[model samples]
Target chain A: MSKKNYIRPLDIKHGRIDMGHGAGGRSAAQLTEELFLAAFDNPFLRQGDDGASFPIPVGARMVMATDGHVVSPLFFPGGDVGALSVHGTVNDVAMLGATPLYLSASFILEEGFALSELKRIVDSMAAAAREAGVPIITGDTKVVERGKGDGVFISTTGVGVVAEGVHISGRNARAGDVLLLSGTIGDHGVAVMSKRASLEFETTMESDTAALHTLVAAMLAAAPGGVRVLRDPTRGGLATTLNEIAGQSGVGMVLEEAAIPVAPQVEAACELLGLDPLYVANEGKLVAICSPESAAAVLAAMQAHPLGAQAVQIGVVTEDAHHFVQMNTSFGGRRVVDWLSGEQLPRIC
Target chain B: MSKKNYIRPLDIKHGRIDMGHGAGGRSAAQLTEELFLAAFDNPFLRQGDDGASFPIPVGARMVMATDGHVVSPLFFPGGDVGALSVHGTVNDVAMLGATPLYLSASFILEEGFALSELKRIVDSMAAAAREAGVPIITGDTKVVERGKGDGVFISTTGVGVVAEGVHISGRNARAGDVLLLSGTIGDHGVAVMSKRASLEFETTMESDTAALHTLVAAMLAAAPGGVRVLRDPTRGGLATTLNEIAGQSGVGMVLEEAAIPVAPQVEAACELLGLDPLYVANEGKLVAICSPESAAAVLAAMQAHPLGAQAVQIGVVTEDAHHFVQMNTSFGGRRVVDWLSGEQLPRIC
Candidate 1:
């Protein structure tokens, strides 16, 4: 700390990132101490080791997940790349019914990017991590030439621990399982798209980018071993995630379109853009499959949590050799909910 | 597996990556199964959950580390980005005196890049993981539009475990401790620089990118609690890393330039480029600090390993409030080995 005091402070208000910030030299150290370290200060990071070392609770299974967030417009209506990066990986670990313990982030910044923007993102990330009760214990930063990279790409890795007797996996879904969703879909995708497309919606739509570990904890607590499969419907959205589970579990699914939750604003925006709500990405929402007997308790637990207040049983797993996902439309006709075939939205996180 | 079988085989021979490959849809799944899954097949990855879950050894401390690789030329004299990505994170975890167990990778690929080249990199990564006996259990991928990214950027996170009674940190270095270097410096930096500059030396030099966990294990076993600090001089090379250690331990250092190890070719290349060997990066080398009584044993252990065959005692820690790293040059002059000030070679990692 004393040694760092002698160096000039980073010009966060007016400076832009340059190759020196990533050279692993004095400028890099100065930037790290002034910006990143100041925001992510903790005992593990304070140790100044190449890695962070911590004690793990005995008998707990370890869960590890990673996500590369390349969302366009770094900032959106409800969230920015910083918050999304933390939430995305945190939810992935939570989807395994584990309690996220720590996170590690890697940043690739393009030269000429604003240091002010970088600081804002980092502050958002720090806030999100605090809200999720997960500390980012270690990280690395690099820089690429101006045209060689986007403004910034954040890659986050989350590590968590699951208590004994909790088993969750896509393959754990059974033919008699019931499917539940933790909130409205299409919000994140539509929000980002709206900003990019400059669509004027009747109401402002915000990205549902959030950490779901607490919601997951509540659900797991209510239906301990009954919860079978948990997954966040992200890039490919609900339809694709369902299809993946159906394939993994060797079963088919039947969804009641009317039971699925979608915000009016998001639905209207999707319709206007010719995008199907089912194929739109989500950041905070999740689809869970559990034993039929546990559906009521799980649903009750989810509804009690703020993040999952819109929880509902939207579908049921069924035995089928073809492993198809069919939706019973509100109009009383059934159609195959096929896997998303192409890019509905690129770099949508 | 059956669901993936129906998708058209990826055109690895002539096709290039498209936006759809990272859309998190059918194509994304196909790319993952055909390319990533096939290469990194293991039980943890086969679980197919949002994250990978595994049981940890009881009472063992956990070590987590991450690194972002943005090397130019993609392929260098001895290694490519893929292998470098694996080695870099693995070494970071090992620096904490831990045995690396698992890795998670996140790739950001520029759209329209060749699939064949991506396959080569992934295959090399898989090979490196296998060689190190570590499994890449979880990962993510994103595609940025052309001009928004270089060919590819990789971020890898490593998780490892350390047995009880193993204490290692940069702050552990004491004033009277001895400093040891694993091998010659500047090879990695000079090699990548040569490839980028198209320099034709009388003899080709290869990037010394390698995993140092085995070498570290040998040294730890030999010296036990006597080993105080360990670090790999990757980005800022020997000088910057040493400065960091000195600052962390609140001590100064005196190095014998005649005793330091540097390959003749690397020396000539650095001289030609007007670079200091101390400031040039090395991928496969490390610096260790230990008590004076344990130096013989630690150096002996390092010499026994092929990666550390050129290990030597190059310096000693000294008590100084200034925390300076001074070297007694072969020319009979003493000079302070300062922290690297600016970018010498960007993206040299």
Candidate 2:
């Protein structure tokens, strides 16, 4: 047909979302066709159905995970909500030693949201997924009245495939397993806090929100059966993640505080904010628990990757009745690291 | 360790959710272990990993869909948020003629919500998934500060498997195809509106929230290739769904208004509210397009299923330049059935 035949192209440059854009009517279609479809253009999504259908790899196992992103500021220094949502779920699937395949995004947009901003976020998400070699095959959009929601909330669900005989789980950690850290911590949390609170610091802080599937794939290849568990310290940070693993495996963790890596700027920011780096979130880093025999191989593989060049062996697992995570401080004191008690910084990821 | 060593049990009967519950600390772990885990217990979830990994069906194609449910009142006469979230995603998967396999639920909870109510919603969601023979394999939870969100917003994503040869899509519709209605329309939308607005009539209305996978499987088995497209008439309701299919298929539709089924109570409720039943959402109903040669067999199968007992032939595909959805009124007049322009009812799910 002709250009005029279709609803006049959305005024994406300066248009504000209205109820009609989410009413599942003509306006919603225009928004989707003109924006989302144009950005996330893939064969599966073009089928025009409630869901997307694609053939799964014949013999590989399917892995699925979902995460809800409610970051305070939609945009941050290093990344925005779009890239964060993509990286967050992709890393979750990779934690299983699985190859990330497809993603489905569901957005809860508040009425009056600017179309231009939405386009920017969607474009960034599409780019992240593409760079990770995963396609956003399907998605859903809903708009809520203003004030009922923050600017936008994105929940990304990803599916991946794991080859046969690959077993990765928090419950697989054993007493002799050594824990490895991918890189410095607390950059993501501090970045978000700085942006949200408008705290100006001498040094610039950026979110470490990068996809880690490649780094994981390389590590898995290096020591496939030796790796016991893999986890990305996000909300409750390294301490909470270690605690979960210890409890799941019925073991204990002993960490050397001096061995753990934290950027100087991040450390100074945390010191100023009275925050604990171990408890601050890190979007790009990971913790790998593997047999002591293969710890060196895994660490070597991690050190070779750009995202994990700062990799180090931070701790070791031990048999303990209490499954506690204790840190031997640089000050010659040891303290038990426990789960977070209450909200520290809300909507960090 | 004894039970006393763990944090005190949550007060399910009278306690309210605080920042601690979502802080990813002791309280968060306790709440997850005592509440969400207790309700959604399964071998996969017990693994305690960032994501769940399961074996994929050998040769079946994977189908995935995600939906954001922000319905109001949390609870309605026929169903609550938990059940609605499950049914909505299940139906979306089934619309692809796939056998629903797994689901992932992500919740964005607002602080200060009641624990008892949250438990009720979780229980209902679990029951719905169990009834449909699908397990929720993985999930994520985040809490926003009070007043930052509605009571709760759920985003459910489902993954299903379709046999190799099965192909169903909105783009498959063709001229001379027959359209089928699974059951009565407007029940779900009206029921929610009634509860939200506190409007009561002589006869009560209830949401038609249900999982339609089994019914869809039966229809696909009986009419395989004959089936062109299967769509759930949700959000923008029947009219919007039909328009979407028409646009996708590059065809038009002619509907007999008298043949479309709407319960008397629902019709009355819509009339009282100055609403059009055609634009009212239905959770338990669907619209199917099939080859005219196989429409009879498909209709017969639908009529036999409990969920599709009220099935009827409501329209037919036609050739038109504009792909307009025009309906013949019961009074022998015809009018264009266009897409929904504005929000008829927001958060109607």
Candidate 3:
């Protein structure tokens, strides 16, 4: 053991967690500050209310989304289950073209969870929720016996309000609409997998786990009527989302490989692992299927937003009973963008 | 093995579940009919929509609630996990004075989860949701590798609309409010524990998992402004719920043990297990704290419902900054109803 351990100020940073952190005691408060408040520092969350209350804007509809995170490892390279949980649900609610607002978190920790690590993850989640302007309010904490549960599982429910005249959905795309892609994909899937697989890459690439609600709001303001559909390509990546839209709307799609974007590192990693980047997951990117007339406006709006800086027009909607998703090749060939049989990188369903 | 195994359609009285029941084919349908539907027969459930659709009444707001069932050993006396899951969430949403409208279900099944068992559960949930005048719509299913997951976990989310001007909460209890309970307590907990402990009761006991929304709606209609607080004593039982309410509303509670109701069988079981029936869980019960003037009206409303036939006035709110929950015993004794220190029984939470 390090000799300095006996002399330090209890080493909140280096120490493992105990029951006191979840005990609603002094340690719990410190954990909240050092870990949660540090990662998420905003006015509403800073208020620390039993429940958050805000003014309801006129002609706006609210969207609420909740998610539970029960990842195995407490700490991951780019993120932990805590922050990912906040971002995952924020994005889900954001995908509806709403201005994401308050968030509620419920944590079920297995007894003996390291307080230090729990604090770290909580801090990260709080930070993300804070920066995204979403406050965590009305949270619940419970502990299960060591053998009865995994380390911890976090469930977050997000609420937001959508402006009027904004209609976006998986089934909104028509036969003549154009589909746009927001930058390179598969970074998130590869990043999480690399950590899980203990693999190393030539260059470190962090998972794209940022909030995209702000970007969505900006696009809605730019071309309110032009947008047809907005969807985050997360679980099954672009292929699955597009396929879902196609099946829901009873339409087909055509994509251009030359226009499609992929990070070189991500592509190489997929090849090495026998995975398809198209089928790989993405947490930060989105697909906007819109009418051709408003394509330029939506593209311009997307590029203006930091998260959508690399946005590009990559496809168009088509009429087909089979609802096949086809993509053009970089080599001037074409192939079907089929449904993923299983998740490219298995984490949780 | 019985030679009758090869014989066609040979069976015992009610029949027992076997491996083939969970295989998702013919036996599944039979199991659904014999077990789930037979117990939960109703009209709306027979339609079997992806989600239930119904019209919302005017002058009322909608409420939605969802709960997940990952309970092991699907079948239990009085109710299995399937029926319990449906009743559990429905009651949560219903306790808020809103009429549950529709429910959405998502199932995560470990590979090889028997089809018959799955069907039985689904049908049971459908029946409960239907009986409660709520529909099951828009469902999802995912299969995980055998070792990666448990047998099955069903998540059900319900939506309901609340009536205007009805403000009910744990924090709404006032200094002079009276507390009332719907019926005898702890039957559900004892029923479940009996099976878990493999103990045969001197008199058979069944769980009290039932819909309380109808009772709640009736209460609201009976005395809209009279009811201040409403809570279903589920996990930590009546004592825990009252304590929470007392803490939240910043008021103390004084209960008369003679006024509280408990089935003799439940009381006997609690004595055998060395557990407090007041702290044991109750699925089909509620604690209502209301103004003294409206107590009779609220009691009358609760009594009109089948779930609240044994409604009783138990206590009253008192002025105390410490928010102590004290009980005056039937034997002219008194004791504090403290917060649950450890689990009454793990996993009941």
Candidate 4:
């Protein structure tokens, strides 16, 4: 196509990338304007400032969180690194009951990384941020030598506001508190690993990567003062995050293995790989510890959200001096759900 | 020496490394107890929560920033990736005029990354943090396969409290704003380049790697409301950062080329490498845009601080139709300074 012919809105499907896309020139501006801004249409980002500026809401405190994404093969079967990065950090800040407002991304690109791929990832990140009602206002870019790094790595930082009279922490888990899972377990991990291992599941399972800030708001509205702890299972996954809470709060937990929600495809993939679904990662899921008196209310709130349709109460806290987590197997026997001993899967997030 | 005898702390140096140090059982605890905790003695870190929580002062906002370091040849003449990682994020948060309080470091290590080298970087980072009065409170560790990643990459996240009544931003610059620079430029860029290229200079230069939040605090104390913007000249260097401020504030600036500071040795190294000091990066320097009314006061305040003893007034902003940042050369010529056409020396940060 002639240059003028290509000046229209980007043809997302038929377009390949060139160096000018990352050149910080007119092409870069066009990419941001046509693809990214279109995907992430938010008021704060519309201002287009080098960095965002805003005030914390009255009677509220601000929370900030950041996460880095360097997943290989930028585009994955389930979700790209861009969407994963947005969801990862947004969930991190939301776990504290904060309303996310703005995000900043820093991209480290390898010399040969395709600009088309970067634009796609950037657009995906922008889409996720917009859907979550958050904005990507500021960003930085740097390129490493071709052999020195992966294709691209993105680090995103987000700022959020937390209303007053709300306090949540990993150490707040108390005995008798209920453990809640936002959705099905191991979907994200299984999806990404399936692509990596060149194996096919019985069904095509997309990774459940999403921002949980809105759901967190709903949960807070339901159980304002009863939410104990909130954490998203990332690297070492469900088993590791829960163990951390158990160790931090000095309390054990009992989980019903069968009651925990895991998709059949994820189960099959785990079985094929000889991996435990319980120990696999979940991007869009969260573990909520709530007071027994408010557990039902919180669950109801979660169920009302589209992202939390499969939310379930899978366990309850227990009193244990050693803070050992135990789970009731489907065979009606109790087994120790200890901290992850060694690496299960790397970079599953 | 026997196997047990070889485990002596100081004697177990300059070796390929074994598993004892990162096991997180006994030897890991020993490294923490004997070296790190001793060097970085702080109440919050001593208590050792998953994260340190403190009382956020009333009427103050908190700022948080995180950065990941994946530089090659981990060690160089003047500093290593360890010190740069800590100082980099702290400076980012401090550029907002916040008082840095705590830092969290997440380490991604290759399975065979030398334990001794790992210990050295940690110690350097710990010492740098302690010296700057910031505590290393919480951290995470992961090991990736050697071929999958570099030797080590350190991701540091920092949290700080912004004092009340202090609002600093790149957009805060206005017409008649004077630009003041602290210390010599290009030292860091030249130092890293020299070591990387094995180049020689009349005088060996050192990387200007130091925490600048204290200087920021001092500048605020001197002219709190007068300081409009503070920026560190990092990856894109001064020329690009100044252009950013100009674009953000919709003002133009004229830099006096001779008034800007550059060490002779650094200038020579840049010349040897075909790099310009104006576009070269700096770690320990900052760009301050303030009202002309308080320029002297801010300059005086910076000069009093050890970190800013060489601070100088470099330029003044003006109302320009083009909103261009130009430099008046020592030889009496003028030219427009633009945002880096591309990153100047990628990954120099």
Task: Arrange candidates by lDDT, descending.
Answer: 1, 2, 4, 3
Grade the docking of candidate 3. incorrect
Cα deviation at A79, candidate 4, in Å, is 2.0
Q: What level of docking quality does candidate 4 show?
A: incorrect
Give the poorly placed runs of model 3, Cα more than 4 Å off: A1-74, A101-108, A137-149, B1-72, B101-112, B135-149, B154-161
**List of chain B TM-scores, one per candidate:** 0.98, 0.98, 0.83, 0.89
Clashing pairs in 4: none
lDDT of candidates 1 onward, in order: 0.93, 0.90, 0.67, 0.73
For candidate 3 chain A, the 10 contiguous residues with the lowest summed lDDT are A1-10
What TM-score does each prediction get for chain A alone? 0.98, 0.98, 0.86, 0.88
Maximum-DockQ candidate: 1
What TM-score does chain A of model 2 get?
0.98
Candidate 4: Cα lDDT at A78: 70
Which parts of model 4 are misplaced by more than 4 Å?
Answer: A1-51, A57-62, A161-165, B1-68, B101-111, B136-144, B155-167
Which stretches of model 1 miss by more than 4 angstroms? A4-7, B4-7
Q: Is the docking of candidate 2 incorrect, acceptable, medium or high quality?
A: medium
Q: In model 4, how well does chain A match by TM-score? A: 0.88
Query: Which model, 1 or 3, shows the larger DockQ?
Result: 1
Model 1: lDDT of residue A6: 39
True lDDT of residue B160, candidate 3 = 53
